[model samples]
Target: MRKLFSYVLSLCLLVGLFAFNGGTAEAATGLTIKDLAGRTVTFDRTPKRVVVLSPGDLHTLQALGVQVVGRPTSATPVDASLQSVPQVGNIHQPNFEKIVSLQPDVVIAGTSFLGHIQKAQSLGLKVVITSGSSVNDIKSSITLLGKLFNKAQKAKVLVGKIDSKVKKYSKTKTKVRAVILFGSGASSLVALPTSFSGDVLAKAGGENIAASFSQLKDYPGYANLSTERIIASNPDVIFIITHANHAETKKAMIKLMSTSSWRNLKAVKNKNVIFLPSELFAASPGVKITNALDHMNKELLKVRAKMKK
Candidate 1:
């Protein structure tokens, strides 16, 4: 009777061990996600060594606490904290030789770098392509990164903050017509669609002049418009996003507008021109978007006050 009882006890222990191991394996399974460029990627496991090809990817990876073994030269100064990381050239054109030397397990890239995707795969490197130029794209990238790094909880928290800020700022009752001038002058004006800057402007309780134009399925960049077009639009407020060193360039553009025949347009006549930090508007999500939103909020308040008077 004692021998039979011992045999039963050993059998139960073996079953429990198998169940535990199976559960662990399931938990460690790598995830499969779609990139912005419409590529399906699968990670065998959490990536320990990563190479980031874009500033946005770098920023997102850092937020997720992933170790970036390689980055682009433009990413130099490496977030101060990551200054020790090696440079692998710029995302527009990456040095595959240097990237291979780094032996990165995974490479994170943007839609612009889709051309190199096949080469990366041929070298036996895993790659993820991120899509969209809007805030929604940012959110998706964050969640995808979270899944890749097994940091889904952290991604949720960060996204929640962004969503909350957008919701709160969007509640302003007053609405004003606004234009986002990328080049600082009336002649070089390009309208940002609701898909890109529209949601940010809307969050600030301002209307984008581009909204008045025909609805475009995709966001347009560096749109060229004639002086006559500017006059016809007649926007109430103008927001300029230019390079930091190009403040004078913006001023020059503004001066040129003043000399134009339509200098009397409402925005110019009232000096409603507002210049924003160039880097903040650069295409990446996260705190940068928050910074842009804050600047927009302040500018909108100024426009609101002026309109009330």
Candidate 2:
């Protein structure tokens, strides 16, 4: 009964939001959803031409096997299928003229790029923001995209797979305290409970030390790194997420470890420092959550074994 009501309510919202968008009173095939920015957005039909700006959004679309017409070439694409698509600047800078040239039916974007959303809407293009910070948000966005693209069946299978992975990797007993760090050098940031990686770490049987520090001044989903807090917390594991190429990320790690104060931390002294790719940490876990969890689980198990020994 609840499922039926949800379906009916979704259908009504789809109709209502589309109509509010000035679309045909009776859309041939459309759905309405409130975007991350709290704007009601509607699509007249399942969008065939999509312009993706965020890698997380691109990966979700890819998981649903949705073919994109445009994406940012400046960063790594979701897969080979989306690699050859037209480039729309980079993550921070979008090329409005190029995006307009594509005439995409809808632009799948992240909440971080509000400027891009405004520009696309100004040019009469429907925009949807799907940036997710936590595990639930990522899962909800996945299901929503699946519904929007009429790929409900595929979405179900994909969603099931994600759930299976989460269950398989999730830890029932957390014995290790961890702190997932992003960026490096003086600009280091700590992943809070609100961040995707932080949730993964907690679920993977590792307690996130920084989970309670949400309101860290200017940081939204992250806590401004304070050596004093970290040293006092005395985390058992320190996982660093780095960006750009492997060489660059490795170099940054070298610099991070070279810091005399950081070297004195318990995690550093015990050689529990782990480095991971930014793909799974810096962005919303998306469909790649499984991969990230698998990696963390392996490391956590090793740490547990060592501690027992």
lDDT of each: 0.71, 0.77
| Candidate 2 lDDT over residue span 35-60, tens digit each | 76677888766788888877777777
Give the clashing pairs for model 1: 36-131
What is the per-residue lDDT of model 1 for residues 62-83, given as tens digits with 9 covering 90 to 100? 7767778897676224467777
TM-score of each: 0.81, 0.84
Query: For model 2, what is the alpha-carbon lDDT of residue 219?
Result: 60
> Top model by lDDT, which number?
2
Q: Which ten residues in a row have the lowest lDDT in candidate 2?
A: 21-30
